[model samples]
Target: MTQHHQPAPAPAPAFAHAQDGTALAYQHRGQGPPLVLLAGQANDHHWWDGVREDFHTVRSTITLDLRGTGDSDKPEGPYSIDQFADDVVAVLNALGIERADVYGTSMGGRVAQSLAIRHPERIRRLVLGCTSPGGPHAVERDASVRRSLAQPDPQAVRRALADLMYSPHWQAAHPGPYRTLGDPRMPAHARRAHLIASNGHDAWSELPRVAAPTLILHGDQDRLTPPDNLPLLASRIPGARTHLFPGARHAYFEECREEAGTLVREFLLEEG
Candidate 1:
């Protein structure tokens, strides 16, 4: 049987002051146990639009723009994943939240790893979506992803993003969403900093320390983050669970949005 959930009300955007005085812009869409949604590099909280309503139906959905993206203050850096983790905790503290279910995708996942390892008490559950724990042993992006990221023109970048985001099947079934993801509004310097920070992420040594209930989601056909590297995450995170969407590409979260939400809902809510 198909499960149904009420759509979340319109999003309410707000700002929380991070420890370093960076103002992280976040949006709240529901009311319940905080379900924090972190976005990948270049993207912001709006990245969760496809799945937000589903999760929001049961949990208070908290979506935040990491340091350099969206409305968040973009300080010149030398940024690290740990700094991002600290920013997340600061946001929670500013909101008077003691504990919340955390969900991070792509680069956000790296930040999530640090959060789980460093501030276990702040997380009720952990969901790592299409992200990696970078280091020497990390899996690299495929040639296609490289080619896409290397595109020089805005049109070229858009085309590459569309290709990177959707599977052929998904694109054929749903037309506009994938094409609409214009490049994330980041200046050249800020973009470089985010990439640098992402490269500096090395949490393999720290994964074993995560204490929250964890779920790992990835795409089998993901060209950006090699799906083959996912097992290392699951094996290391105490009792972490994983789900790989077949034939799904980098934007598997959208390709499998409903399933992703259901899986998270089940894990967070312990639903039957």
Candidate 2:
């Protein structure tokens, strides 16, 4: 069967972060209230490149390359979701932001959840995209897929991940840009570290404690986390609302950028 796809959008501006004197790199754009973005495992802020402008239209957007990805420092092992959440807190602290809306995708979503659970006062609103409640059901990625990502050959890995990242229709519609964004030279150790931290995460038990208003977005066709995860996540977080896009995949933000941005803006505005 044939599928439909949306045209891809252009990239946004780049921003640098003096994260605790570490010089972390990020992308900043948009205007209005501050909205921080977190990327997925084995991906950097570049994952948001296509959707940053859309987000900026409604609110000031900040997208970061976490410690080990993009141009950020890739320190050795012992990486935990909580530690990554601290890195996010450091970014906000360095920028003198006491509180702001937070949006996280996949691993980034995990970080956002952790931040909300551990440091509730710092988050004004929360958006978890293409994410799962970290537990048994979440650790079901195909073995071959896991193996490829663990020790990926840059080019081959990018190609392999492309299939998992976007819907088939979206892939066909914007093949060039998707391929380019996926071509970064991610190391095996870094990928493994991220996977370990993400899979080891278990925040479902603590999610009900989050006080911030929350929004959960997921793609119906997302093979990575599966749409079922969205309901699970929303159920765990009190008062959390969810939106599932039909025919979308793991990169739902990119595939449905405009819709996603609109939903997020409306949710924040109504809740605030």
Sequence-dependent TM-score of model 1:
0.92
162-253 in candidate 1: lDDT tens per residue?
A: 77778877888988755225326777777888889899888888888998988999999887788876898887889888999998887787
Candidates' C-alpha lDDT: 0.81, 0.77
Cα lDDT of model 2 overall?
0.77
Q: How well does model 1 score by local distance difference test?
A: 0.81
Models 1 onward score TM values of 0.92, 0.86
lDDT of 2 by residue, 189-269 (tens): 777788789888889789999999999999888777777888888888999999999888888887887788788878878
Best by TM-score: 1
* Stretches > 4 Å off in candidate 2: 1-23, 137-139, 143-154, 179-183
